[model samples]
Target: MRPQRRKTMGSMKKASVLLLLFLSLLLIASEEMVAVEGRTCESASSRFKGTCVRSSNCASVCQGEGFPDGRCEGLRRRCMCRKPC
Candidate 1:
């Protein structure tokens, strides 16, 4: 009986640890999504170049325009010029 109880407790502990790990992963994923949505750039020049901007002329085009925001950030991440928000 004692051995059986010990086994059950060990199994329960493993399950609890797995559950915590899963929850942590989920939280990290959600945080990444939020960062993606919140990130923004004013112009192509302000962009992170290869990291965000693709067009060589993007900076020239966006220079005079207002800074990009919200969905624009996502577009820039894809290496595309987006309208300012």
Candidate 2:
């Protein structure tokens, strides 16, 4: 937006520069989001018998399976183990 540069450049050049700057900003934002993301997954425990009713119970069994914590989910509410990737 310098006065001398503004007088020399046409409207199309200004619009192109603005569009390039906006795209660069979007690229930066997307990279930041991807870097902050974490991994999470669930798996049924073979040792955990029957239907899972409580998170506490699922957590205990998940710990036994070497996972840090777990929860009960799905329509049947099976024990789903979780761990960091």
Candidate 3:
């Protein structure tokens, strides 16, 4: 009976250790995800001429204007440039 009790205690300790390890791994993964993600901000393109048409065209003009990307947005269909803020 005493030997069986000891075995159960040992198994419980191993289970606790595994649980702690899994929790720590999850915490580290979450922190890395948060670090990788960022808020994106947008502004109307200064160099884009006329009303926005194709998204590809807007993106090209925004690239020349030093932004990472762009899109035609809103009812006015303006070329909006975007980047991490």
Candidate 4:
């Protein structure tokens, strides 16, 4: 009976560890998806142009056109057009 109890405890521990790992992976995946979404929104050619453009204020010259915003204030700034929601 003692050995059986030990086996059960070990299995439980393994299950707990697996659950933690799964949760961690899920979190990481979610974060990555958010980042991708942000990048897509911030892209100049995004279908949604106003939303990304509103979040940042910078001046930029894109394809010979100039845009002024806070993002333009930063060095190495690039122009991105966002669509408003």
Q: What local distance difference test score does each model get? A: 0.53, 0.87, 0.93, 0.47
Instruction: Give, for candidate 1, the lowest lDDT window spanning 10 residues.
Output: 64-73
- Deviation from truth (RMSD, Å), model 4: 10.6
For candidate 2, write residues 1-85 as lDDT tens digits: 5687666677769889999999999998878444665798777886888889999999999999999999999999899999877
Q: Please give, for residues 1-85, the per-residue lDDT of candidate 1 as tens digits.
A: 3779889899999999999999999998878443345433333334434554444445443543443321224643633444524
Best by TM-score: 3
Tens-place lDDT per residue, model 3, 4-40, is: 9889999999999999999999998878443577899
The 10-residue segment of model 4 with minimum total lDDT is 65-74
For lDDT, candidate 1 versus 4, the one ahead is 1
TM-score of 2: 0.55
lDDT computed for candidate 2: 0.87
User: How well does candidate 1 score on lDDT at residue 59?
Assistant: 45
Backbone N/Cα/C clashes per model: 1, 0, 0, 18
Worst 10-residue stretch by lDDT in candidate 3?
Answer: 29-38
| C-alpha TM-scores of all predictions | 0.38, 0.55, 0.57, 0.37
By TM-score, rank the candidates, best first: 3, 2, 1, 4
Model 4, residue 7: distance off in Å is 0.5
